[model samples]
Target: MPEETAKQTHFYSVEAPDGSYDLRIEEMLARIESTAAPIYMRLINGKIPEHQDKMDMAQFLAVMVVRTPGSRKDAAEMVGRMIQIRNYATGVHDRAFNSLVHRIEQGEGRQLTEESRTSLRRSLIDPSGYRLELGKEWALQHLTAADKLTPVLFQMRWRTIGAAQGFFITSDDPVVRWVEPKTWHPIYGDHGYLNKTAVVTFPLTPKVMLAMSWEDEGANAFAGRQGVDRLNRLRALQADEYLYAHLDHEVIRRMAVATKGSRPRMTTEGFGPKKFAATTLRRGRANRPS
Candidate 1:
């Protein structure tokens, strides 16, 4: 367990007995089905998020592929067009930085010191929110200058968290600063990453039970359906324990059976940080700033 927080969390190891786990997963499934928000209500899942099982854990990373519009019929031409547009945007933004600095110096009635000038330049290049997707090799393989669909690539970092409030896990960045990294990392490769093997985790918070399926293929892998969900919270356990001991625990039973398979992960890096398999990506709903 990561350092105990004010909210003390108990550990639930995947290596524990399978017989006991079956019944426990059932109870968790029952709790979530009756309490979690519906799929049509996903817009609000960000606030309350979704509940997850104790073992619903894996490290996730992602990148994007965007199709572009053109008639030149060559991959290079398509890439060139994108570069032109990006450069134009960068130039415009750089000018705005100069203007802001000019105003600050004028308003203060003093020229910017050398150190201040360096700081201003650094701030101009820092990522505003999430970093822009920048891989062109993958894009070139799927596109040509003649293709009208332009795919842009944005990479997502592998994130760890204490508890899953919902269906997705936010990265260890400035955005979701509350999540803590806790896991048994047998998968860490020589590069010191969790991208090598599948990991099971014990989330401190409850997680929703949802099914994920692919709706598109190839460059359209990002498209998928987020199924309905259920939660497994400590409070839910208490409420249901007394009410109905055996009243329809099928939902949870089914979920436990399904989870024994491989974890669903999303990433552009095929196989993993080390090519564990010849594959790439998983399905989930991720938020991006408009």
Candidate 2:
């Protein structure tokens, strides 16, 4: 709905007989924004959020995490991967195809003609090349997952970093999950959102950003030039396609150049974003650059 490009498209839309899909999600998002607007204004005005504000903000962040194009594409890719695995399952694919061929022959009370059999065989094998379309169920699954993740995010220590000199930029996939490289394992593969060292960052505004971590110390602080630049770089790399900022600055241009080809991409063929690994100081105070 945010006009980044000339194209306009619907959000959270799905085909349903009762029209509940669009109505329900639209109403829910409306309510969330209605409650969150005050908190957003408070933050922009440099006021610390109260307990209720944090709760509402947490839910908003959780929904944002699941409601983006990147997230939906990721879900679609997962569905495609599951289908691919099922199609290529050991012995199962062949057995199923053969069984279908046999059933066609039996149902017609005669062997299938060569042309008919060939067509059937091709149809059976075609799924291997097909990518599964994510249905309404995927939306439900992501919303449920976000519901579970909200409490965990709320429990983490939160701090707001104001960009004093430089400004912060956001992207299509603005919420970034950074896994501490020291604790990262290739086998595990970026699998820790609840981990003590995991850092989740969201840009509240060009001048303010929010950070959640278990090991960080500051509750509220200002980011120096280096800190703002580092966070902006992470955002640029995390973006799927579009980046948003108040101004078209040289810093943003530099970020585009510095993080070229690093934007996380999700494909229909089950390929996902390349894993991003880096270390950033939490609140620019707890960990100092050497």
Most accurate candidate by lDDT: 2
Tens digits of per-residue lDDT, candidate 1, 17-107, equal: 3322223423443444343324213422322222341112110101011122111112333343343334334434767657767878999
Note the Cα lDDT for every prediction shown: 0.28, 0.68
Model 2: residues with Cα > 4 Å off, grouped in runs: 1-9, 17-21, 90-93, 100-140, 257-260, 264-290
Candidate 1 stretches greater than 4 Å from native:
1-5, 8-94, 106-109, 126-290
**Clashing residue pairs in candidate 2, if any?**
none
lDDT of 2 by residue, 127-187 (tens): 4443344454454456656787778777878878899888999999888888778887646
